[model samples]
Target: MTSPGVHAFLIIVRVDRFTPEEKNTVDFIKKIFGDGAAKYCIVVFTREDQLEEGQTIDDFINSSDQLKELVQCCGNHKFAINNKLNGQPLKIKIDQLLRMIDQMVQSNRGKYYTNDMYQKIERQRKREQARQEEEDRKKKKAYEESLISTGREIGRQEAEERERERQKEQKSREKEPQKTEKPEKEQYSTREKICGCSCHKYPGVIHVVPCCSGTKFPFSLLGP
Candidate 1:
């Protein structure tokens, strides 16, 4: 059944005794083909000759809840056949089973379960996972870069603040040096007289006399 797929799954059982394991066969098939397999299933009850006289398949199914539940899971499609029959009777049973399968196919819109369908679902799932991972990676990278940028800005601001504080401290401690200046010398006049004499008559005689105060007088200033 796994090589390709099938249009229907016939669950065969004996009408004389429907075992617990047999009742769960449809569930096992669903596990293999997925939940959609149930719609394409048909429960076929064999050994109809063992049934009580005037007992129909529906009457037998209604008597047991387990059988009824199983049939309902298969869209309530069920059939009974006596394997001991031959010729036209056996052919009729086979033809009826085939007709039921054809009706199911028509109800399914002419589509069959295939391995390709499962593969396509798996491929789509992988593609979606890859896309989500890529998006998450981009978001994480952007968040890291933003954090780095914020850290650099904070470091720059702190450095600038430290430099400003240092400059202010230096300015507060600075002072100008004091300066000293020299005094100027006194100037002397040359027109002062040393003695009380009128010496305006002298023509060229140059003299140097010393007064009592130790000051010097010229010869042109001596008295007659």
Candidate 2:
């Protein structure tokens, strides 16, 4: 009968004696079907006739913190029913329970409970997590690559700027005037020719003549 899936899980418990085991009932259901089972749960508190006069279901729920927490975990969906009731009263409570189940179905977007649903949902979650991680890794890699590329570009630009400065300095040096060396002073000899003779008489040079007399003169003496 349960091959297809169940729309609601009626967790019936006696209101007169809400035991500790009863408080842990929803937890057991979660253990079997998964945490999503809580949304489809409708807590049916049987034996509402035992409640003291003027003591409502809310009053009973508020009396116990554990019970209250459990109910809250089940989306606060609860119903009180007196099993001894007959006829239209029972019918009305049954109708209200059906309506609550219908509302729960609508809230769940017309989904039902199955073990396969939990496994499928877990698989989807894992797939989504892996996809997100892969995307993040790609983004990180791209960012790192961009940083390295930017650094290289900056280094290239700086090198180009330095080269330009060097070229500019070289051109400036080429445009500047050059210094010329002074000409060397003429050298003069201290000795000179003495007497006039057929031999060449050289100024500022000494000569011993083969004339009637051989003589030598200083550089200050001039030949006649």
Candidate 3:
């Protein structure tokens, strides 16, 4: 009988004597459950006195492939119950199995099943960061280029201004007049002068006066 509240627990009880119907039931269980039934424990109940002198339960089921498959399907998890003894060991084993299941569930509690989703998110974040960095680099390069062009323009302007100032100075220098020094005046003394005239004081302005005979002054009498 299946309990509605105990969906995680699957109990399969075998009859005291094995029959075709019982074997068919076990087969049906295996077919229906498969690996899905690995969550449950396999409880094998047996009467201890029914066993042969040298035979063990492990030896008995070793030849049954179906039984082996059933145990393997449950991840080889099995607990034996001897009906002739107290059920303390079975209870303890069931408790331990439940604790293991609890631990498994706890360990996987925070685990995300979809690694692809996380990877996609991480990739997108990196791409966006790279794009932003590229944009920033372009903007910085453009700003530096602008500053270089401005500097060149300023240098050209200063050169033109200096050239204009030099031209203006050169033209002013050329337009100014150049001064010339006057020559010294010649000296004369009366005693050294010819015709005994005070040439220095009188500085005679000679007139060619005609005598009574109308004779002209000789050219040789004038100073050479």
Candidate 4:
């Protein structure tokens, strides 16, 4: 028979006689309560207690591998009880079982199960962030280098273009002609000559005069 209480006590009764329905009920109880079924203990209860009168619980458990395995699954906790009596032994066993539960709860206080997993996740996130930062740094450096190279190429082209324009201007100046200034003119006076006297048959003249101004000869005149 199973009873409901504030706290469940898992009592495993290893008995000689169990109906199929009772076995099924025990399986159902274990499934429903699970690990929350506290203060659990395995009791080897039987009407014939003489079978284990001289043997300890450990001795009997060790006598068979199946029994040893069962006890191990129950946290190696077992008790011998008389099925015909409800006495001090049962109370003492229950009290010890409760104390063991209290100790287990105390030992596990403030402890979590997923701490290692959380740490692993944090480390993974940091690694990924670092990888992304490195990639970004490489990309930015490559972009800056490309920009610098492009700027250099453009500057070189512009310098060559300026040099070409200068040369073209020089050639044009060489092909043009130069202009010069004209000189001034000068003035001069004209002179005239005349004869003073002439011989008709002999054709001899002794004085000379200017035709336009009437100037006389100075030295001698045969005829004036």
State each candidate's clash count.
1, 0, 0, 0
Cα lDDT for residue 102, candidate 3? 55
Residue by residue across 40-78, what tens digits does model 3's lDDT show? 434353564466678776765565676665556545554
lDDT (CA) per prediction: 0.78, 0.80, 0.53, 0.53
C-alpha TM-scores of all predictions? 0.52, 0.51, 0.33, 0.31
Over the stretch 1-224, how does candidate 4's per-residue lDDT look in tens digits? 22222222344545445345533443443444443222243434344354556775566557766565555555555565555556887688667766665554444452322334344555766787899999999999999999999999999999999999999999999899966666553231122333444333443543345323355544343443
For lDDT, the strongest prediction is 2
Worst 10 residues of 4 by lDDT: 1-10
List model 2 lDDT by residue over 70-110, tens digit each. Answer: 88989999988997998999899899999999999889988
TM-score ranking of the models: 1, 2, 3, 4
What are the runs in model 3 whose C-alpha is more than 4 Å off? 1-113, 181-224
For every candidate, C-alpha RMSD to the true structure in Å? 15.8, 11.5, 23.0, 23.6
Model 1, 93-191: lDDT tens digits are 899889988898788887666677656545666787799999999999999999999999999999999999999988876754446667664233224
